[model samples]
Target chain A: MSMTKLTLQIDGRSIETESGRTILEVCKENDITILTMCHLKGITDVGACRLCLVEIEGVSKLMSACTTKVADKMIIRTSTEKIKRYQRITTELFAAERNHVCSVCIANGHCELQKLAYDVKMDHIRYPYLFPQCEVDTSHPLYVLDHNRCIVCTRCVRVCAEVEGAYNWDVMNRGTNVRIISDFNTPWGESITCSDCGKCVEACPTGALWPKAVVQGQLNKAPEFISDLIEKRKMKL
Target chain B: MRVRKAKKEAEISKNDPRVKFLANKIKKENYSPGSLIEILHTAQNAFGYLPLNVLQYITKALKLPPARVFSTVTFYHFFSLKSKGEHTCLVCTGTACYVKGAQAIVNELEKQFGLHSGQVTPDNKLGVAVARCIGACGIAPAVVLDDEVLAKVEPQELTQKIKSKLAAS
Candidate 1:
C-alpha cells in the first residue's frame, strides 16, 4: 500500500507523518502520551473516551486525537490548562460513578486509569460516588465481571465485532447505565457462540472482566503488545 | 480578582523537603499551567500528596494564580490535591474486561478490603479505583496491583494473589 506524508504541529513541535495516521498515533509516536481513557491502537477509533482531547490552533472546540487525522500545517495543543482540566473532569466523572478503589483493584499498579489519576495527581474525587450496583457474572469459567469498575470505553465491543469477527459482545442501554452484554443478554459462559478465545477480556483495560484466577488489584492486561503485533502485520501487508 | 488572591496564598515553605526538591528541579523560569500537571506529579512523587501548602508554593513558583492552580489540580484525575492511601489499586472496567468478569473481581476485592471502589480503607493502607480503560484490553479482566499488571485472572486466583501480596508485605 502506498502511503502519503503530511506535516502537522503537535504541541508546537512540527513533525511529519504518513497520511491516514490519526492524531493519537502521531502523538504516541512522538511521545506526547495524550491522556486517553479510550482510543486504543489497532482498533478502530470511536472517540468515546474523550480523554485525548486537544485544541487545534484554528479550531474553536477541542478535538479527540483518536478520531482526528493530522493535516498539513495543522497545529495542535495537547497540554493546555483548559485541555487538562477537561481531561481531569472526564476522569473524575468516571471515577465517581463507579468503584475505583485503586488500592484493592486487581489492576491497581498497572491500570491506565489509576496511572492517569496518579499522573494527574487526583487525590480526592470532588463528586459523590454513585456506587451504582451492577451484576457480577462469573459463569464464564475463565473470567469474572465487576460492573462497578467499568468506564465504558467500548474497546471490547469494537474489537470483538471488528477485529475478532465474533460480535459476541455489545453495549446495551445508554449514558451512565451503559454496559457490555452477550447474546440475548445471557451469561457469558452460556453464550455458546462465544469462541472462548478470550480476546474481549484481554481487550478490556479495567477490572470489568478478568480471568477468575486473577484477584482484584492483581489483574494486568497489556494491549500494547497486541497493537505492536497488529502494526507489524499491517507493515507486512 | 478571586484568582489572584488565591495565587498569593499558594506559596510553599522553603524548609519543606518537597519544596526544596521542586525548587531545585523546577526552575523559576518559564512556568505555565500546562506544565502544572507535570510539576504536581513530580511533587506528589516527592511528597506523597499535594498538600495545601505545596499548592501555594507551586502557585507562587509557577506564577500562576492559586485558583488557577487549584482549578487545574481539581480538573485532572492524575493530580491528587489530598492525601492518598499508601497502596492504590486500579481496575479496568472497559468493554473487554467487563464481559470477562471484571466486575466480580472488583466485588470480591471490595468485600475483602471493606472499602468500596474509589475509597480508602479505614486504616488508609489501600485505595481502590476503577478506570475506563488501561489500553490493555487484550488481557481481559485486567487489574493493576500498585503498578503491576495481572492479566487474565480468575476470582479465586485474584483472592490468592491479593492474599499473597499482603502476606509478602
Candidate 2:
C-alpha cells in the first residue's frame, strides 16, 4: 500500500503533505503555529478544547485542525481575524471557567494554559469569573489533583487509558459543575485500577495534576514523553 | 442481630432488578461501547441516579475504562451519579430571573426546606436544582416544581406553595 502525497494551503502558503495527515500535522511539519489543547500526540484527538479551531475556505463553521484530516488542495487559514478573535475568546473562557490564579498555581511558570494565554495575548478576561468552589484531592500519596486549575482537557484521562492502560481518571457532573474524578468519582489513592505510573501527571497541561514533591513554580512536566512513548510502541507493532 | 441485619440488607440489594437489568442491557448490546450511553440512561431510569457500584459494573461489563464511562456520565445534565429525592424543584437563573431575585427564592428554599442546589433533602422529600435558563425568561423568577412551573414567583410564595403541597400530599 503506497501512501499518496497531497497538498494543502495554510495561511496562504502552499504546503505539501501526505494524503491522510491532519491539518494540524501538516502545520506542525511545515512550522505553522496552530494553538491546541486536548490534542496529545500519543492519544486520539477528542477536540474537547476549541483553541485549535481553524477557518477552511469551503467550511462555514470553524473546524479543529487536529481532528480534520487534510484533503487535496484544501485552503486553511489558521491566523485569520475570525480565528484570532475566537482563539482569544477560547483562551479567556479557559481562564474564566476555572480558578486559574497564576500566582498560586503549582505550574505557574510552566503551564501550557498560561503559555496559551500569553500566546493569544489574553490581557484580561471579559467573562465573569465563575468562582465555583472546587476541591483539591490530596488522596494520592504521590500526586495531587487540584480541581481549581483544571481545564477539563482530559489529557490525564486519555493518557491513562491509551498509554498506561490503567483507566483510573474520570470526570463527573455537567457544564459549570464538571469535575475530574478517579475510578467512579473516588479519590485517586483509593482507585482500584490506578497503576501509580504518574503518566497522567506528566500528561496534564496545567497545575491540576502535580506530583506531591513539587511546589508551585518548581514543577517540570514532559508531555512530549507521551509522544515518544507512542512512537516507541509503534516500532513493536 | 447485626449479622441478621447485614444479611437482610444484602438480600434486599441482591433482589434489586436494576443490577440484573444493567447486566442484561450489556448482553443485549453485545458488550459494545457504542451502547454505553443508552445502558447508562436505562441504569439511571432504573436506579434514579448512577451509583459508583453500578458504574463499575457497566465499565467491567462493557470492557471500558471507568474514566470513559464517568466522563460520559458527567458530560450530560440528564445523568446524575448522586442520589436525588422523590420530588424535584428547579429554579431558573436566567438574566431576567436573576435580576428579578431568583437567588432569593433559592435561599428561601434552602432556609425553609433545607434544600440546597444540586442536593436532596435529608428526609428524601425534595431535591433542588438550578437551571441557567429554562426558556421561562418571559416569566421572570420562575420556579419549576416537578412537572409544574410557577411563573413570576416570589420567595415567600414558593415556600408557602411547597410547604402546603408537601403537607397536603
Candidate 3:
C-alpha cells in the first residue's frame, strides 16, 4: 500500500515525513532540537515527562512530540518562547522536587538531567527545595536505586518490562508521593522477580539507577544501545 | 529463565496458601487481564494487604507482567501492601478539612498515641490514615472510624474516641 508523505513545518523549516513517524523521530533525524527525558526507544512512550511538549497550531494545550504521531501539514513548533519557558520550568521543577545536588551525584557530568539543565540554560531552581528524605537501596549486588534523584519517568520500569522481559520495577503512590519500587514494593536486593540484568540501570535518564561497579562521576551509560538491542532482536540469525 | 523459576518458587514457598488463593481467584476470572483489579480487590479483602507473593501469583496466573500488577496495586490508595491494625481511622485532610483544623487533629493523635498518619500503633490496636478527602466536605475535618464517619471533631475528643475505639476492638 502506497501512503502519502506529509509535509510539516517545524521551527520554520518545512520537512517531509511519512505517516506513523513521531515528531520526535522526525526532529531527531533532521537534527531539529526537541528535549526529552522519559523516552526510551525500545519501550512504549508514556510521555511521563513533560519536557518534550510542543505547541501545535490551533491546539490550546501543548502535546508531547514523542507520543504525537506526525500528521499531514501539521504546523508544529518545537522551539518557541513559551515552549522554552515551559522547558526551563520543567527542568527546574525536576531539580527542586528531588535531591539533585550535581556535585554528589554518580551521573554527574554524564547525566541527562544535568545536560538538560544546561540545554535549557537553567541557572538555579527558583522553587523551594523539597529535600524529601528519599531512600537509597543498595540491596542488589550490582545496582543502587536512589529515590532522591528519581524524576519518576518510569523508564526503568518500562525497560525492565519491555526489553529485559522482567517486570520488576514499578511506581507506587501518586503525585509527589509516587516512588519506583521493586517487586511488590520490596527492596531491589530482595526482589524475587528481577533478573538483575542491568538494563534498567542503563535505561535510567538520571542518577536514580546505577551500577554498583562504578563510583560517582565515573559512571557511563549508553541508552541508545537499548534501541540497538531491540533492532538486533529482529534478525533471526 | 532457570534463575527466574528458582526465585519464584522460593517466593511462593512461604506464602503458599495466600498465593494459591490468589491463583484460584485469577483462574476464576478466567485469566482475563481486564479483571486484574477486581481479582486484586478480592485478594486484598481476603488477606487485608496485597503481598509480593499474591501479586506474583496474580502475574503468573493472568499471564501478565509483574510490573503491571505491581503498578495497579500501588496506583490506588484503596489497596495497601502493609498490614493494618485491628481498628482503622481515616482522617480527611482536604482543603476544607485543613481550613477546619485537620492538622491539629493529626498532630494531636501523633502526640498522644505516638502514631503518625498511615501508621499502625506498635500494639497493632489502631491504624491512622491520612486521606485527601472523603467526599464529606460539608462535614469538614471528618474522621472515619471503621465504617462510621465522625464529623466536626475536636483533637482531644477525637483522641479519646480513638482510644475507646481501639479498646473496644
Cα misplacement distance, residue A179 of candidate 2 (Å):
1.7
Clashing pairs in model 3, backbone N/Cα/C closer than 3 A: A139-A189
Better of 1 and 2 by TM-score: 2
lDDT for residue A184 in candidate 1, whole number 0-100: 38
lDDT of 1 by residue, B62-116 (tens): 7654434554555567777555677777789999999998899889887887767
Model 1 / residue A187 / CA error / Å? 1.0
Ranking by TM-score: 3, 2, 1
* TM-score, predicted candidate 1 vs. hidden true structure: 0.56
CAPRI docking class of candidate 2: acceptable
**What TM-score quantifies how close candidate 3 is to the native fold?**
0.83
Name the 10 consecutive residues with the lowest summed lDDT in model 2 chain B.
B1-10
Error of 1 at B167 (Å): 71
- lDDT per residue as tens, model 1, A1-237: 568888888877989999877888899899997887777678888898888899999899999988998888899999999988887888888899887777777777877788888777787788888887788888887777678778888877777776666666766655666667764355877653466767767778877778888765667787775577567767744
Mark the regions of model 2 whose C-alpha exceeds 4 Å error after superposition: B1-12, B86-121, B125-169
**DockQ of all candidate complexes:** 0.01, 0.34, 0.41
- Clashes (backbone N, CA, C under 3 Å), per candidate, total 105, 0, 1
lDDT of 2 by residue, A56-115 (tens): 898999999999989998999999899999999999999999789999888989999999
lDDT of each residue in B12-62, candidate 3, tens digit only: 554458656766777788999999999989888777787666677777778
Q: Give the runs in model 1 whose Cα sits over 4 Å from its true position.
A: A1-3, A229-237, B1-169
